[model samples]
Target: MIAKSNEARCTSCHAGYGWKGNDFDFTDQTGVDCLVCHEQTGTYKKFPAGAGNPAPREMVFPGNGKTYHPPDWNKVAQSVGRPTRNNCGTCHFFGGGGDGVKHGDLDSSLMKPNKMLDVHMGTDGQNFDCVRCHSTTLHNIAGRVYTTPAYEHRKSLIEDDLASKITCESCHSSSPHKEDAKANDHTDKVACQSCHVPRFARVNPTKMWWDWSQAGKKKNGKPYKVKGELERPEYDTLKGDMKWAKDVVPEYYWYNGSIEHLTVKDVIDPGKDVVINRPVGDKDDIHSRIFPFKVHRGKQPYDKVNKTLVVPHLFPKGPADADAYWKTFDWGKAIAFGMDYTGLPYSGEYDFVETSYVFPITHMVAPKDNVVACKECHAHEGGRLAKLTGFYMPGRDNFRALDTLGWIVVIGALLGVVLHGLGRVFTANGRKEQ
Candidate 1:
């Protein structure tokens, strides 16, 4: 789907080369140009100094030469993220036919964006305006925007560890792989995209919800339909079967609040009950960094599951055991059992999942151990004494438990020393009497 921006507008990145359709213009500074987005546009100028050198490819301006950099190259021009009220709203302002509030209803801005009718999601809270966070602009356009550290999605990703493909291995290798007859050894494997590369931009952070009303057997993940409208992938399933999705999975109700959808419904358990409890589009995910790119948190080689993150599970209303569905899980056990439960099937040395399916699509080099870093190491710490309880959900505090254990150990050691001292005194008295 198109962004919530003006259709005739030009892209911030591709300056002179191209624009969406035929809307791009070289001299159209009134709309968009290389300098329109790239240049550190201060008060709108004809040009800046250092006209001889050109800017770097990441931030190429229309006319200005590259900004001179120091020896370290750390001073690379930082590109702004979100649009500023002045930068974007100017075109979308009054006389231009923009929403009078800059981020409000569409009235008169240059040309209004087509996405959101109202900018902010708040219905009752303080009405947020463009100038709230983005108070300044380079070319009267703000550079970056504020974001949440964590996510706010409908589907609880705790159980969908198999779906997240942050690392190279996940997409590259399929699970339940039994290469050898004995199924004990696996040494070799390949990256995922080797075979299942994408025709379109099938990148990270996919939507994980399905509309049950629009779902069926083939669409419900029934025995991998190859040639029906109910195919799983819908457009691209495996490498050679890219055409299978249209035939296999028809009427796929996947929508990321936009088109080019990716979905997984029956979220309560991959569609046992027909009603959908989770819909990805309903999520309001906020990223600590550049969204999907910052998949891992805490450290490198982190738990890919935690990296994907999720909202607290919402119990189904219609389902019989809706309460059971909402039952708090042994979050630690869930992860530990996941690891200890299903070790990767290696081919004496090579993995069959990596060899046959997952690796080709992911284009990832299969992990040697096939073990999740966070699951194995974090067992007793936050893993053991965890909880997801109440309407205002909060995870259990395991650190406090550890501290209590530490005090117990310390007191136990002191008691042992006191007992030893008493025993020595008793022994000395007995020897003296003798």
Candidate 2:
């Protein structure tokens, strides 16, 4: 709960004011930090731990020693305009503690992308802002990830009654391929992102793994971090072992837009990998289509006896919060404190469980030339969609009886053509002799 622990390290971005506790009024318009989204001055920044409020005065942040200065209210207020890529990315790009950590497709790189990175958002291309497609009306932005339909029925804006919510069909109609009729036929079975996006984390490395079991390790009585690829942390004493990846190929799945999340009270099977959140759809589902996803795998604390995932108070309240896992480096104390605060029943026994979370890849739109090739998914060996079975694909699938019968018919047709040509030559020679 926000009333306890340092979860504001994660929640502050979603909360609009000093929402460090539950008592923070959600209905109060005075608490809204409009500058976060509207200010064009390019100076406003939310303090990482300030519960959504900008620093009241100049101060230096601890550890990183980054200096924070209060914004010039008059300058920022006068400069307020429509939100740009920078405005939306302030929180989204830095989700899950750092840039490109949560959503592999979204990052600061998109703020000023090149044509190869994103055709729409590229500074050198269409130069469209995030609000261009995600049109806002009365604070409700179009294209909410989880709430959106898996596939849009509308062909274009002409037929779309749900004008406020945008999809690929909003601009690029269902049959977008003018040249390739085969690609157009794929619309009913495959998502646009499954082909257009191709890969995510193109510009930056995204976090792929986090093992909480490896946390609390220290060197010489002091916690430290070990940097790995791209100078990113592979191991942090405060968190755990981490794995990051760049230009990652996505896992294909049948998603119908619905997602099932594992709650704290939900029972789980320790024998299997616990899916933290999964897209709800199957091959037989009419609404489902083959979509791309960044599947993040990790290990996290769970109640062994209750068979439920447990939340650990990882972030500290301040420098000397003994109950916090980051400060004390004690799992027992941290889990106990967190479980107690949440009013969840927790047995004394705890263990780490393998978990997976799925993130749909939609951003980092490549140019038409860079879209996923037909061979990538339609090949017989090692295809991208090889894992998704129960469907007949042209080049990817084969039926032994059908293949044999087709080859026989082709051979018979060739023999018939040769014999007819020879008979015609013989008849011409006999006529000449007569």
Candidate 3:
């Protein structure tokens, strides 16, 4: 199941490499094609149907009685230079098959962005690239995955260093706000991205929901799809029903830089929505901070008999693969093939259950001037952090005793000032009459 899906879905972005065979063997040096990243020629293309390899020009127009000439490999090699945002955007920006499908923070708009869109990558600002923050060394990147971070602190590079040194603090420092002490104090309880990002999918809509239970719906014996607003697919026979949103405010959560992922082996309760992945943190933890996240909700397949999530073979490598879900639209066949491929047991019973996965919003950092204001989260009611507990925000959270004491102090001060003014005015009038 994994192999078949990789051959179809994974290859969409992992293409242009020389990957071979069905298994994921890192020893297969053939898969690592340097030209995919270094080649400056836009003519370089990859075959999405193949396993991340450049498609033969003939395959594009097969048997047309025309001999299609290949691109000049020598010229492309000579033109190779540093990778640009376009090279990285080819995979990162279009993560889950389409533009703004996975990460709300990333999209094609980052390419040649202006200062209004992003402060770092803006053409009018710093104009920094991905490598600037995600610095790499010896092919090991400095950034962490969305679910986990190897390191959250800046450290010197050394052998056997497992922690990642790349972080917003590496440049911004712990005290980012120089003028505002109040803003600087928030660093301990709030993440840099929480206020800076404000919102995600600012330029494009991101996939907010996926309902696999609705898949395999066909009309007139043909797979059907419905288009939604902004040219996004509302429903598809292959995937399922989807919901998308733009300029979305992120869900706030306290994150301590740890995560728990629901693996294939974990048994889940059928009654509740299973969390596919979530950050492990709380308001009480010292290391934790209020962070912004994109909570992606979906309905995915699970083994009704075994009570565990099942990975289905959604894509097929060839036309003859009947077990492929997209090709056959048969859940039973797809689940069976998937379980057998993964060497897991199947009880022949499958059902769809609601699930959710959380993705941290770290990109699309707006300019300092455009950050979330204090009142957004510090209001008396309906604040952004109103749902967050364990800490007492000045205006948001209230204690009865503290409020009474504060009112008493204020009234006492006001009465004293009024009495002193009245006494002075009466004494002056008496002196004038005398």
Write candidate 2's Cα lDDT for 1-434 as tens digits: 12345546654577547775756676786666788889998899877777876778987866367888888989999999999999989988988878888899998899899989998889998998989988877877777656455434545776765564357877887788887778899887798999999899999899999898998888999899999967689999887999999999999999887677778889999899999888878888877878899999989888899998877787777777888887788889988888887788999789999999999888898999999999999899999999999888989999989899999999999999889888879888478778
TM-score of each: 0.21, 0.88, 0.85
lDDT of 1 at 75: 26
Write model 3 residue lDDT over 302-407, tens digit each, in one string: 9999999897988775779999887899999999988887778899999899999888898888999999999999898889888887778888888889889999
Report the CA-based lDDT of candidate 2 relative to the real structure: 0.83
- How displaced is residue 296 in candidate 2, in Å? 1.0
Could you give the candidate ranking by lDDT, starting with the highest?
2, 3, 1
lDDT tens digits by residue: candidate 1, 153-235? 22222445433323322323333246652212221221122212211111111112212111123335432324334322322
Question: Candidate 3: global Cα-lDDT?
Answer: 0.79
Q: Ranking by TM-score, best first?
A: 2, 3, 1
Best by lDDT: 2
- Provide the lDDT at 330 for model 1: 25
